[model samples]
Target: MDDSIKPNEDIGACIPRLRRYARALLGVRGEADDLVQDTLERAWRKLHLWRRDTELRPWLFSIMHNIFIDQRRRAPEETVSLDEHALEFPVAPAQERMMEMVDLESALRMLPAEQREVILLVGLEQLAYKDVAVALGIPVGTVMSRLSRGRERLRELMEGRQRVVALKVVK
Candidate 1:
């Protein structure tokens, strides 16, 4: 068995878990799959450096997470137009609610990458503190701190949204 092929196979086996992690990170299923594919591409490119005995899943996840962060950093902030004709325009009441979920997911995307990453790892991915620390290349204490800060930021963002709604009601 070629040594390089073994690592590629191991990474291939971890794709499902990586996709799940990416889904939690990006919220959009398609975007998550794209992130997973990008991670696999990066992993395959760096196969020679991968240690045989080290865990592959976390390394793959870390790659995915970093790629997400880099992409977010590089993306331009464009204002979304609210043209009615442009919107898909869901009619069903339940569908409207689903659209709101998508809006919430978009808001989540706006969060700081470190906070978002921490929330996805601990809250969504259900990884242990130690594992998350190892994957993030940070101390377990740092993981806890990031999680706390991330939750607080999320709460503040939600509260601000509520205030806007309340103001509109008062008007």
Candidate 2:
């Protein structure tokens, strides 16, 4: 019975980033969308609980991480299909960049969940290490450790993949 009459307007600015994180976390557009919606809904309801002086982004992400784990526990593990949309590209001019992104996504998927969450929050979302810890409910040291290990594994994964060079011939 204590929702905020006026929530921070800036909260909306984080939606795009939240959507990106959710998509990366869940790997399915529909499921990711649902997760984002659930996070927002929970944040809205718990607006009163948020301290005005603290950052909102991490709080929202924390809610999302918690929801993801809870849902994961209640349901049996299912093989997450490689999101087809991540593979789609406009044309060849940017195909190289698109392919690189696909490789990155593939590598990310291979990481342990904790490490992946840390890497995504820290590297992709650009959240500070402390902020990432807050979101994942881990210590900053743990966040650093995970990030370090995740980056190393990703580098190893990417290095193992045969690099493709798309050459454009100009006559």
Worst 10-residue lDDT window for candidate 2 reads 162-171
lDDT agreement with native, every candidate: 0.73, 0.82
Write model 2 residue lDDT over 41-133, tens digit each, in one string.
999899888877778899999999999889978885757566655543345568788777788878888888888899899888999999999
In model 2, what is the error at residue 2, expressed in angstroms?
Answer: 16
lDDT of candidate model 1 versus the reference: 0.73
Off by over 4 Å in 1: 1-10, 27-32, 69-100
Instruction: Judge candidate 2 at residue 43 and give its lDDT.
Output: 90
Error of 1 at 146 (Å): 1.2
- The runs of at least 3 residues in candidate 2 whose Cα sits more than 4 Å from the true structure, single-residue gaps closed, are 1-8, 82-92, 163-171
Q: State residue 126's C-alpha deviation in candidate 1, in Å.
A: 1.1
Among residues 3 or more apart in sequence or in different chains, the pairs in candidate 2 whose N, CA or C atoms overlap within 3 Å are none
